[model samples]
Target: MTTHITGTREEWLAARLELLNAEKELTRRSDELSRRRQELPWVRVDKEYKFETEEGSASLADLFRGRSQLLVYHFMFGPDYKAGCVSCSAIADGFNGIAVHLANHDVTLSAVSRASLAKLLAYRRRMGWTFPWASSGDGRFNFDFNVAFTEEQQREGAVEYNFQRAGHAMDATPVPLPVAQSAAMTGTDATTYSLDRPGLSAFVLEDGVVYHTYSAYARGLDGLWGMYQWLDRAPKGRNETGIWFRRHDEYDRR
Candidate 1:
């Protein structure tokens, strides 16, 4: 009655054992990649970046909060959007529980966006998230980090994200379906929504100076999306088809 392959217990164990060996190898490779990420050179941050945080206006270094390291999630909440990106919101959900533990380990984790602090706070309350969310509305922090793009860049198809000239689909004559859908969810047009991209950046404060360590974007961020990790182990894997997720709260409404 099942469409999937059915196997005897003995056959299943043999196949699972083979998978376990491959899984172990993948784990070892992941560990090596992490080490290589740490080995990458840190670039000194000379520009003074400002952010509006819950406490008050704070500098990039101030974001460390007495910690030596900082991890910033470049959330896509442009000033014009009525709400945050649903994809980024899903990622932030995972951030809430781990932030306190990371703080205890001498690392500060925060989400930075181009939206106003007031808007961010209201949305944070809406989402019931306690993790620090800062607004980079007054500064070039998002742009300098290559997550926010200017109008000219978008118009000219000159936006560069994840270390390459990108956003072509977003700039197409007819916006891509998924991009348009995501934009609609945020109450923004496709171009306006695409102007702000999602990413993660790492920083370290050494001897009173902040240095950029590493950054990842696009599929590079898959590891950080908690649900995908679980889904990968599910019978149907990701089982995705054109924007299947919502802003945690939107699911119930559906």
Candidate 2:
């Protein structure tokens, strides 16, 4: 009684072959886009941003960690939050696996957050992640990168996120359900949680100078979320409802 299509072997092969052609075309397009991304102009970073890492304090350049390139995952863990954003945690679960590979390729991968070093370390330990994570709690690094915002920005309704001035969830009188859920999971209210957004930033150190190479926010980060990449190839392609994910540890309990 299943409503799904039931076809002969030959029919299935024909349909799959048609889909294969489209997939190949998409792959070529993705490659070209990547080439264009690398060609984008780099902006020099002059700000003396500092971060609290496990090895005492570190500078933005030091994050390169003897590598020429740095890829920072701007994790959504605000100073006030009790936990990291669940979605961000999900994305971060893949980081530890790839961190060593990227380091060997001369690119250092890291996660930066506004949470305190102690808090970050505690959560990282709970998750059993070995990747380098830094706390930007006392620095303008997160704000400068457009990943973190202030209360004033939320109140004034002048926040520019995802490359445009959009109405933030923090500004909404009644917080949206997804934002509320995420906030509660982070052990914060909607407003405090909304102050932090998810993003990825790329940097390069050349001639003793750090250059901002590229950044992606919101859906632009989808390509890097390993789980979703697999789900996209599944039969139902990210068949999502409202906030269906949890921090990896929470899933088993649920």
For model 1, state the Cα shift of residue 207 in Å: 0.6
Compose the digit string of candidate 1's lDDT tens values, residues 1-254: 98999999999999999999999999999999999999999999999889999899999999999999999999999999999999999888999889999999999999999999999999999999999889999589999998999999988888888888864456566877888999999999897898899999999999999999999988889988999999999999998877899988878763
Pairs that collide, model 2 = none
lDDT of each residue in 1-254, candidate 2, tens digit only? 97889899999999999999999999999999999999999999999999999999999999999999999999999988999999899999999889999999999999999999999999999999999999998589999999988889888887889888876554567778888888999999898899999999999999999999999998899988899999998988999877999888787762
- Report the alpha-carbon TM-score of model 2 versus the true structure: 0.96
Provide the overall lDDT of each model, using Cα atoms, as 2-decimal numbers: 0.92, 0.92
TM-score of each: 0.97, 0.96
